[model samples]
Target chain A: MADGVAAHSERKKTGNVVEIGFTGDDAALVRALENGHPGAPAALFDRHAPHVRRMLVRLLGHDQELADLLHEVFARALKNIAQLREPARLRQWLVGVAVHTARGHIRARTRRRWLRLASDETMPEPAAPGIDPAAVEAMRCTYAVLQKLPADQRIAFALRFIAGLELKDVAEAAGVSLATIKRRLARAEKRFVALARREPPLEPWLAASTRWRDLRDDDDGGDGGEAAR
Target chain B: MTGGLQALGRVAGETAEAVAEPRAEREIAAARERLVGAREGTVALGRELATSQDQLLAYPGDDTLARARQRLLAGRRRAAGLPGFVRLAVPLAVCLLIAVAIIFGLRAREPQRAATATAVSYLVGTRAGTLGERVSAFAPRLGAAPAPELRFSDGSTVDLERASSARVTALDARGAEVDLERGAARVFVNPRRITRWTLHAGPFTVHVVGTRFRLAWDASTKRFSLQMTKGKVRVEGPTIGERQLVAGQRLDVDLSQRVSRAQTAAAKAQPSARPLAAQGASGRRHRRPVRPARQRLARTTRARRFERVEPMPAATPAPAPATATPAPAPAPARPTTLARALQHVGAGRFCQANGLLDDKALSATLAKAPAKALLALGDAARYCSAQQRARTIYLALWRRFARSPSAAAAALALARLSHTKGASALQLQQAERWLQRVSAANGASAAQQRIAAARRVELAFARRQTRRACALAREFLARWSAGSAARYVKQVAVRCKLTPERKRR
Candidate 1:
């Protein structure tokens, strides 16, 4: 994947035969889409679809339904492209749509309580042999607890903590006010902490919550990629 | 603990990427090919699905394929048949656009209904300091009998009577304020969409709600009189008290006890109380409207009812603080949780401020508080080390009330937060954007704008754009000179050696 991305080194000059990724600011691509340029939508799919897919999958852990959700997300995006008043916020908007889609998945799971959810069987493939077992178990334990949360709370928690969206963006994606998002977060955090306490595999994480700010990785500037001027 | 949460999220994200995301990519590729193929006349849209039990065993998405197939079949049938939804796609899309155009088009014209009235933007004097320079306050000398006309952007007029002068102290999206010094002033606040226009006349404050009124202060007589010939005005003063006067009514300031109506204003004031048209007013230059006419009345233009002299008044008359918690009445039933938090923030009692703000009850006001309240909340969150919350609240205040002074302050706060620790190039650019917003705000104080400009020089220095930094530092130092911002900018220039030590003799 790194090599694939490396092949496209930021489109140095205009009118070059750019690769799958448009390698230009989102605004230019949006303008092309508005003009009905055929390649622009494909470029948008290549640029944003990966991130959108990643966000939805992370929020709705190991769901086979991801493909349907993916089609719905892009179909809706294509249909509503012009509805976006600010094209510069394309990434945020796409991620918002993914989060909304994830919420729908969670709601469905909530309603289908009787369906035997194939949980642990579908966890991601194991890391290389040298990887820490505790970290692997921590990941498993984290999802185990997340599956219990209400849809709104789970979405808020995922967007706020997992995706690391700013509170404003999270509130926007969830279509709720900032205060309401905070309220939801407070409840979710409280429940998550209470649940994590019972899982011994998550003991370190539970303890780390007390000093989470101290141990977190340095913010080498979040992927807050530049917006169009 | 926050770090732990972040770690958990990283692990969760990576795991999902390793499993679900890969699956997602493969599926999307498959779906895209089918959809695009159907559109481009390549492969047939979709193949028939197997039985449900076979589908469950063979593929993860038999249902999704069925749905897509049905859609494709519908499209194919439409293409071959007389008419269908797909056949009508172009016309349907055009109709949708036309409907959207109609909705927003009507919305575009909504402001013009208010356009029938005009509001003052600038009060220019014939001999004013510099003609056409936008200044916050205008104090014009009484040169002629009519004095100089207050010329709004729309070219509407107001005149300070002879021997009278007024200084416009502040003008904001909400309203305008002018300090009436020493004599009477005839104000023609043309039917304005803005809710409030206030003139601080001597001992009294005359609040105009889109009306023509005359407020006279007899300095020698030590008396103030408010005559409302059109619309209504609420007058408040120390001894004169507060009184609401409607059209055809007059209130006289009796230094003895309270504001009292002297008499019903006679018919003489009513007939002549006509709203002054730009063309009718004498000596008024009828310049073309400064802004496009259609764009003129787009802003909310809500006449914010006079929010008493002091913002955040302590005494809210509501007896029950619990039931009415949602509304942060301009006044509060109790010493506001926000006010107390602000005090705590000032006193550096960060824990207490944080505690107060974190209360479940206080969250109600967090959403709807005025810009000033939001500022204090942002400050409290910042001091408590809740950087994310602080940034969110500051950004909200900046976005919702961009025309207020608090918004500019929020911009500066966000800029400062951005550069806190090893800020990235993108973060620095974001800071630059915030500073630009501050410098651009018409409502921001001169001091705040100057500080923001100086900070930009500092950002340049931090980015190692030494040449640019030095030049900006020199410019900043020259402009700010003795101001608080000058010292840092001067140091930056001197350190960068952009400004050399005095040439050796």
Candidate 2:
């Protein structure tokens, strides 16, 4: 379905399907989904899958299970839509659910890695097909730095920098107070920048923060899609 | 955080998505197709949940009540979306129904099991209407109508006749102590495992270990009766004092102050009272004091011999002195070999029992002995696989004492022998009849009914009666999960397979 819409977008040379947001009010859409209208969840999926998938990929870094994660996120949303009190913030609530799911996956993976330490093997870094070697090395070093950080810090840094979410949005997704996110980000940024300084491939990224921020704004429309900042 | 990976992502993030691969697209497409094709989402959720998903994504759709709540939530959402006036009317209707339900629910009180504790109100073989007292309480009162029955967890059952009531004051591994308030009850105690039981029936208290017997008490009439169908019971009361009631003997307590003679099938049979005792296969001794006998009533008319009927109240104020027929006094207990043998068998010392019965000194005693000695000898011989001896003993007991409890057991034993090689169809028919009558056998005589039931199922299966065998097998499993023939029953069930053709009722 995502491919169908991407293909359609290609034919038209227009934006992705998510850009054509469902027209109904969030409250009405939630009620319709709760009512088991069938079409409502499909519409919700169409409206949110690309956004959720994009955010998950950014946070997890080339997550191979992006498809399953997207299904899980939307299935949860569809299931719990009735419990959503603030219909106007449906997108924000969805982000909270997605953050929880991602954290669980991270924790489970950490446990698995700990259990399998006798094998003395880690998952090999995914081989990208056509990416620049320099950019790939920098990205690889970024994940390595993130891996050393606690789960909360990793999530805060991914949301604030990789996904380009504001500090308030980061707090919302992490289901924590704004103060907590601020503290996490402050602590994470100090560790992240210090760690990045040790990686030779990330030297260029630290030197051009302003230019990089500009590139991010040009690519993203302040929502989940391919983003730069 | 932003200055580190955030800056790095701002620097190199574009590369990850820039190289979006075919495999990733294919993976995403597979998930999308599954999501699209999912019809029963709850079923998919159930299947998915076995692999521990995060709590946030896990749905509680598996539980019936939870699914109901989901449907209710959807209904509520739909109702909320309706116009304000419509929503107002729905809540009012719901409130009225709730009020009505509470009102009606209070009027029809239901027996509620104490879920948190084993202190529950359990009624079986009868209903609440049959009870003379309240059925449900923090502590339940179990009662029954004529021939009231009580079932214990260890597969032993008790039946009370003529409007009986009893309270299980305490229950534990040693078995239970029942305080029978009134009337009569026969206990079909499980003898396979040793268990001590005491019955407090009015003035008389009967103590027993693993046995079958009947005890009855009437406060108004000052009448107490104790009959040991199998095993031994010691009865204690004011009138009868303390005397052990052996198998095939009836001790009755009348209005008279002194103990009377216990009724026996053979007039010349010796009176034997032996406390129940057993030695384990390892030669370990176990003993439980038996209840004393109340002595038997005088011989009545042949028509009313088995059943004891209450005399109609005298209508006239002045009545002539009752013409009581005096029976000959009972002979003193003789320490004969035959009496000792019967006592040994009743106490489960079967080797000594059979050995004594084998002696030439007791040959004359066995020839004309009562049902007590006959049943004991039959049991002793049968235990030792002396089929010919058992048949002779059981046949005599069955013929001379048809109404006695021993007769039923003897007939069933004969039924077993009748199934032997080269048996006539008439003999098999007689065995089947005995098995069926085992169902009708009341109180103490019904001890072997469970084994008889299992044997019936085994017989059906052996005869290749597929449908009948399947039905009996199913019934047997439901009735007794681990009955005597549980392995045979399970085998029959597997053989039958509950096929649609077999289940064509």
Candidate 3:
């Protein structure tokens, strides 16, 4: 039985693990990269690249754009790996990079729109295949709503709700004060809830969702019934 | 509930029907797995980058660190410039800088300051209006300039001019400390950090750690009043002689003469009774202290009394004892004013609710009732043209119940009103100011969220991004259609051209 297990593991290694160079702990990988071990960096990239790409895809709503951005993120990460003080935090470091890359893309896109001739047509919807149609539609709606928010608030909302990063992580990644992040998050959530409530078809979803309802209820109670809907 | 369940079931059925084929299910599962993998990868990367940034930021003055810092800052700037990015970036940045700064800066500075052999001395004074050229000369000496005109989150101000010769040690995230050599200096501790504003007066060291507390240290008489408006403070050393100050209490550290027994007795007496006496001396009626558990019961009673339902005259004719009183008419089934007010508000009859509140009568009634009732009334009167009345109620509430949730609510409302007619920039500024106050008092998450949303609206408006503002306005309206501020949302929507009638759905 031991022989059989060993044989199976060896075969698996031959097929998958051999494609990349050395595979071990994250620290080992970092050490390898430090030593300029061939293909060692690629192994690290293989482990983390897909996740970064997905984040970009979700944030930008375009796979091709995400793919391009993913390449840049890896290249930058690889170049700066030696400078990474804590190899253990490589994941957070990469995500932060992805967030910034996504932001740059969005900014460039917005700037381009401003430079071009004005069009009456609405934003073009992205094609997402084989996903839950409702979830995709909701995301699209959310994206449209997000475009209406100020840049700071939108980023805060994305980091907090969409990305589900902790308040501390979000603040650190964004390089703002905790208070500023709090202020932005507070406003963004309020605006998001308010906007979500205003959409006719989306109203039920907002009201029915416990999270949404709680946000509305909290805001309503605090403001002395001033803006409660 | 059954209907809701049925609707849910139908939706689920439709979703299932759409993916009936095994091939479709397999495809969906694969797609979902891929998405999950992707999401995990993104999160991992984000975490890794954040960690790396943290490590870099934590490095002890690494020159290469500046490049990483600039990258992070650039990313922040870009994110800040992106619509709806504040939610993600603001907190991340804030926590990174302030929290880390507070933790590390305090640790690094504490030992250095404590080890210093010479006390740095300078003159401290306040200047009104612009902080002029002389300001730079005076800046090093002044520990903290608390302008009375400048209201901070802590609700107290320090008059720097009052303490002319105070020495400053260090200024970090926690706040500044001063070595008080002569005369009295008053310091109000802000709530953001657990700041120990230590005033090292001769023979007396007063430490104010949190909230709106005033510490006055006098050199000649050696008298200090640590008046705690909110939160608590602990005073130690020979000057205080083992005394602690709680909220709404004042500890007078008097050393003019030998420590008198009478003053000690007065200080030891029930703290709340002093406020009661002050209230009585001002010709205001006082109510018996209801049990704290029954505090809500008192509010309900006061709310009922405000309704003014006429009591039935005593039974004139004597019938059988049990039947004569007519079962006391079940206490006349008085309708609670809060319920009535809420009803009127729900029906869009804000004017009626305002009328019921009788803003004029509130001053006398509020003096006797719990501050919460007045706060509620002020909130109700916000929509009415009675701005003065609303302002009065809020101010009174703030003064009487400064630390209460109601006070914060009133302050926020008043601040909002003050900003309404101002320019967009002014409004944004005011909103930011109010948000700071709200955040300090540990505001409700919902209130914070609304502030966030309003900020976005204000930001978009300021940038002349009318289309984006309109879109946001529409979302706000949709989410808060039944919210109390729905009308305000509607108004903003109309202004932004987000109204359904103005733009195609």
Candidate 4:
């Protein structure tokens, strides 16, 4: 009975801290952000910046330019903060902004390749220390294949699976309907698997599993609902 | 009993519901794990598959977050500071630039247009387009080394040698007319079923359907020349009138001298026969031994008769003495041995002609016989069905007077005899070699050259060398589209499926 009281007290303390930080809720935080409250940018950054950075790294595959891309995403989100339709969905809106920034960079990089002004040698190396060399090499191979995919499909794939976003969140981030995101993911999954099968380092990752095999048999129904959950 | 059964049923229903709920929850959890990876348990294989991508997770350092915050605030400030119109106009300009780039990119993928048929032929080969970007009939094109070649749609080509200038005078789908303005050009006309090509140089015009030849015209000298290496062509000009030339023949015309000469290799090899027409201007200084008065009278009569039979004018056999009296009967009462033989042959009495030509007395003087007499004696023997005798006579003519103008005719006769239907393979090979000699022999007459070229095609077809036969047939048809042998050559080309042009529908 004492242990239960202590757990309840700890939960109450966490709730109080959340209430104190934004002064009320996410709606209040969005208002403060829109009004350019002196503390609002720092508060938003502290809350969502890490999430956005993780999304970018997953999408672009450990690029050295990850920091710059992160900055671009936040800058766009703040500049277009007025365009956010729902104040309560600020985090979701920020995710959408990050997807847009990644897509733009992808398109710009493709253009540079077409113009022969840039090449594979110019791609930045993974900057994070303490990463396994094999993992880094696999990440390099994954991005190389990803670069060959269309921008919309690449973003959808990255958001849905790599970043572990729920199906609806992926749809919202890509500015597409939930059904469209599902279709994009299906195609991206097949294509990515087909391409990844060619890479020796990525082979083990795509190895068949009992759960995945069972899911594939009954994949038609409830996949979106389950993924969303 | 009924109440007890109802209670049991309720208990079973409750038990069934209890058993199904956790299983459904476990399945849902597994599905979630499949998509988002296992959050709190041992990693599933599905999540492990993305080992590389899963490892890509990174959190921004404090410094990165600070810079990003500053950048966001600064952007917000910049947006607030900007006037509304400037902000809208900047994006609009960027969109316009993108639109322009898209338009250019689409245009770049389009193919270049081909030149029109009015061009007659276009420049092609190594130096294509160097003669200007366009080609039109009647437009003189000058070319030198590294000169652009003119190519017709039908696959004909004219390679202009250095310092040469030529122009297309007329054009159509079937063939074209080219005028060699100055210098030299090597022309190749693709033989089509209905070709009608013409090449003009100065006052001379060579009509060709398909052929390969070199044509040159010198404006200052008023001279025109054509050397045929393949096929046949009809050349019309001053002095030459209309003459059919074939592969291995060369024709040179001098307007100032009112002279035109066609020759072949055999004729060129003859030192004495080379300058017969050229020496006409030098008159009587080089006149030979005077014949007896009676012999001179008989020679003049025979020359008159031979003139009617021979196509090309031959040199006066032996000039008549100035003091010789004219014969009243106009017949050779006691003609020389050669004159007697020629008369019999001209009258179709081949047996009588052969008998006289094969006489022991004639054999002693055969070494000194003129090329004309030797050629006439071979013809008489051939017509009399004296194969061995004719072969012997022709060989003698070719050997003793290898450089004589008539030697080409002798070689042609040998080729024909060897190419006969009953001849062996060895004979056919011999015939082909003879024809090659006739074609390559310098100063050979045009008629003999034509006969030799046509004979070669026949020999090749007979030997079942289909490719060579078709090639030679195409060449023959190019030069002699309306020639007597054209029908035969065209048939060969059609049979071989190597006709230069596609068959007309």
Candidate 5:
């Protein structure tokens, strides 16, 4: 699993050579995309796809159709490149597109559930050969709880906690004001905690986490974080 | 926690070299600290999930990006193949469909009843909800940050400011009646052919027919205040009965003190009023020194409908060696100067008032004089069209008493005077700086703060700082989305082309 993840980074380092690399800043890339330059799409993908993919995986969990969803996100971005309001903020805009894509997929899955066609377990497992079982179970349990949340709240929570984006970035990705995102994250956190408590597999982790948090609180004398900002 | 857990899990089996986010763990740890006081189980949940960030963020394979790029470029190729008109067809058809629906909907909907009055009130600012939500009559409209506004169907609006509460008591075709139970509310009644709106605050009743005013009632102190910004209204209350307030006038009724003062622009004389002793029937500026007897008479008759003259004890026996009364009075030199300035201003002799409140005397008394006196002198300068003198006095007031309750008013006055017609860019910039001062004033009135915020947006837009204007407009809309000026702010937002997130970003 480490090799696979590390290999992805390695491939990018080498892939820059084989591909006719079109290197530019975000604004230049946006111009390229808008101009329909032949290599713009690949250049954009190679530059931004990793962050978008990470955001999507955090937002939607480990789904089998992740690749297709990633494709759809870039496709939408490529199609609407000219509509990007601030070319300087292309990364944030792309993250927004990914969040939107994940939200749509979550809604579609929910609709499928309403029609009795799919379940949460229906997502095929990713083929990470040497991943730890505990890590895998934690991921599964976390996303299972996320499944019960509203799509918007889930996006906010996943982008904030799982992807470790700043609050403003999370808000940007969710296409909401920072205050609105805070409110949604607040609701999502409460709901996620409640749902996670119902899952027995997460009990030990929750207990350990509580103990760790208490110790950290005592150690730091309890000040707030960049989250508030 | 995420990094720590990843390391622990690595010790359990997986390698530690591929820990994706070491710095992210620090941030997550800080974020989890905010969840410490959250509801039970929430902190633990945030902690557990935050610790699993590495597991959750799976790096995508090279094939994914390659495949996505191919599809994206292919899609772009297909889109290019389509004709330009065909590209516009879908949106045009949808717009046409919406237009037809709107037309049919309007035709099918019953016409609004002329005898019925309707209003929708919504909260704005940090806790803002939908921009427009219908509020039933008699339902109390509560204020929040920045304020809550009740928008009437007739384009009128009532903004509840500073923890205020109000409700519509009676609504009808002629207009609606709003009762301010407590706190302050700024009302703007749209001008109509037969507009009739009445506002009740405590024992005071303000009868309106196409006007804009701010009415406040403090039940604890039994104080009722009205500041008429535009048009006119008739206020009936204790101490002041049926007082007519025109544009740029303010009335404050204090039941505690049994005094009601009406502050006017002091430039216009009341209709059918007796002429001032100095200024004859010709309405010409007069320079004759007014006698004490006629000054008293002028204050009595002129203040009856215009301003309430509160005589300062220091103004008495100014430089007069009187043998009748012998009380140790602090040197009456500067105090008498300020008093005479106020007396001239109260008597509607603004030019005389400005002449008395010169730069040297004003500076000498700026610290000792009460903020109210300085404000009065400044207003007199403004009314007298002495913009430079008014600017000096207002700027001094703001600088000397920056923390006083009157500082915000002084700043606001300075801003308005500096940004007057034909103001240079430098003056406009100075006006913007003064507006920022008002906004930053700790003890500033909510109304003043709201006005400053709105003006800041407009000033920025006028100065071609579209980005700042858009940012300020978005902030103003966030807090005062249901406000009277929200439409203009939204227009500014549209002109700047800022999306909500991007604007905030």
Candidate 6:
């Protein structure tokens, strides 16, 4: 890992010296890619995959989906490398691709709901209750309440609170005014608080219940220290 | 409520104590360790995916690469066979042929359609910003207002005043009925068609073929009033009244009461023989005879009733013009800059006004303006353009502001710009780095989301896994379908074979 990081840094430096503007190295990578250099694409993938994977995990709410998506993102990036205009902004470009791909995923899910209303799977139950039941319940309630908000508000709230992004970043990502983001967050917070109060603490109870204990016992190894904690 | 508040207070206090108390330091450390473990797990998984992508791409003589190369070669061959001249000409010729075919096809089919089918007409003008426009856009249109006494070809008459935001959905041989919601409208139906006309508002229904009556409903009040202006109307069902309202008469249908009241107030309000004109029918003839005496009595009664209502206070006269310096009278309109033009555009109330301006407007708006305002307007235009899927506008904005020192705003815009087609992967990576820099510098909230969303799209394409691609596409679509990125979401979904489904509550 250290060697990979060093090599990546060295490539970045060499690439940076070759070009003058913001995406100098990226441009060189594109040129190298066009010339069929072996390391150009690998370096690009290594640099950006982590950020993209983090985003996918947060977005899809599942590890398996994120893993699958991360692979696809890089492969498509390599295949379409020749089409890239600015190599320096490759990370952003990849991110854009992920966003587009994720959007398609969401749209398809929405359409499938009508055909398979009962078949749609619920979120997976957490394996063990290491975290406080109340906190877990809070998180579940937060997600449920968030689902009720308008798309823009939900995006802003998620970006702001769950992902812990700054106001300006949220605004930019949402492509709205700071004022608008503020407004959405305010409204979302109000609705979330109201919903949290009104809904019973079902998730908390479930987490604390004996069924959860048994499930944890079955899933964990014979030693139950981690499961109990 | 108090109990709930106390519980919340206790929870907050506990959390605070957990964080600040020295005794809990070990617990906090343990929690941090757990969090680090989680992060490390995620990082390891990400590394594995990255390594796999690298290996796949690096495979010697990979079948996927070979296939893609073959496809490209075939595409090139196909392109070469068509001479440049023919290549251009064929597309033009095909387009012209298709256009002609469509025109002729429509023309040939036109005559077979029914002649009296009325095209859907919008009665409430949409103004976008105003309450009326918002209401009309958000709320469903009820049925059309019925003429005072003239029955439509479909034999339905509606009360115009009680038919606020109503529309005529169907007018055919079966007769017509007015669908109304909140607001008041009066309808006058031809007596001959009385049995065929109907009035519907919320849960209440009134059947009439020939009647001149007013229907008023206040959604807030939950009260419905139906007053006859001419002819007669019979109430049935929930409202069981067999009263006939003559000329200069009124009837009130209390849907909640199941009892309607007949009053002679109509006669006391109208003195003239003039009748209210039906909406959207400039030259339609009145179907009911005018009774002048009863109308006169109705007018006097209405005048007296109006007198009893409180009069609006008169506006106070403006302070006497300053003797020394009268405010300059407004100057005649003058040619304006892009900013001024934007203001005008704003006034026009187009949803995509900022996006509609030419590059000249952008430069002009930015010139001499504060950086913050310029950035705000640019951001707004970027969003507006994104919503409209105006690629040219986004490109223009990027070219103008990509490297500016506006920090968060410029970097975010650049990231979006670099993500578009025709941009190289290297450029996109740099854009992502810039976004990360911005996030680190200013802690912008949307950067992570934007980065995440973009990454998901990239990964899906890289893997060529249709199911995974579809799933990610749906997630993004659900979040952005109502935002400025809806069009991009649609494009991605179409490419990925993911159809967005409407969210069910």
The per-model DockQ list reads 0.04, 0.03, 0.02, 0.12, 0.10, 0.01
The DockQ-based order of candidates, best leading, equals 4, 5, 1, 2, 3, 6
Error of 1 at B38 (Å): 51
For each candidate, what is the lDDT?
A: 0.55, 0.52, 0.48, 0.60, 0.61, 0.43
Error of 6 at B284 (Å): 45
Restricted to chain B, the TM-score per model reads 0.32, 0.29, 0.24, 0.33, 0.34, 0.23
Model 5 misplaced regions, further than 4 Å:
A1-21, A120-124, A211-229, B1-62, B76-505
Q: Docking quality tier of candidate 6? A: incorrect
Error of 4 at B397 (Å): 34
Pairs in steric clash, model 1: A209-B1, A211-B1, A212-B1, A212-B2, A212-B3, A213-B3, B195-B303, B240-B259
Q: Could you give candidate 4's per-residue lDDT for residues B1-505 as a string of tens digits?
A: 1222233223222322222243443443343344333321112222322333333332133255565666665654222322466557657868989999998875563222112223344555634433323332222335522655787777889876645567775665557777776667789999976577888776567899899988877654445778788999998653455689999888876542234567985675665333332232121233433455455445444554443343222221222222331211211222476566666655545567678754564565356666666666676576456878878877888888775557777887787667653468999999898888775454577656765676677678668787898889888878888644455456556645632232220
Query: Candidates ranked by lDDT, best first?
Result: 5, 4, 1, 2, 3, 6
lDDT of 5 by residue, A1-229 (tens): 3322222221223654533345667877777667655556777887888667766766776676666888888888887888898989998999999988889989987875674445446453354533446556767788888888899988887776656566777788888898888778666655665676777777665565663335234443433232223
Candidate 2 residue lDDT tens string, B224-334: 667778988777543344668778887765431222447754532543422111011111222322322211112222112221221111000110111321211211333
Candidates 2 and 4 compared: the better one by DockQ is 4
Candidate 1: stretches off by over 4 Å: A1-23, A115-131, A211-229, B1-505
Over B285-347, each residue of candidate 5 has an lDDT whose tens digit, in order, gives 334444564554444343332222221011101111122213222224476766666666555
Better structure of 1 and 4 per DockQ: 4
Per-residue C-alpha lDDT of model 1 across residues B1-505, encoded as one tens digit per residue: 3333333334333333433333444443343334333321001100101011111222343244344333432322212321354446646767989999999998787556444444336746654323223222223335523356676553334566545556776554434667766556677776544455677765467777688877776543335677776888887654334568888877665321112234575643553222222112222333423443223211101101111221111111111122222333432423477666655544445456667765453545555677666776676566456778778878888877876677888888888667543468899999888888886544677766776777787678668777888888787777778643565466566646722221110
TM-score per candidate, chains pooled: 0.28, 0.28, 0.29, 0.39, 0.33, 0.27
Quality class of the docking in candidate 2, CAPRI style: incorrect
The C-alpha interface RMSD of every prediction is 17.4, 18.2, 16.5, 15.4, 8.1, 16.5
Q: What clash count goes with each model? A: 8, 14, 87, 16, 1, 117
Greater-lDDT candidate between 4 and 5: 5
Best by DockQ: 4
TM-score (chain A only) for the predictions, listed in order? 0.73, 0.74, 0.74, 0.77, 0.81, 0.56
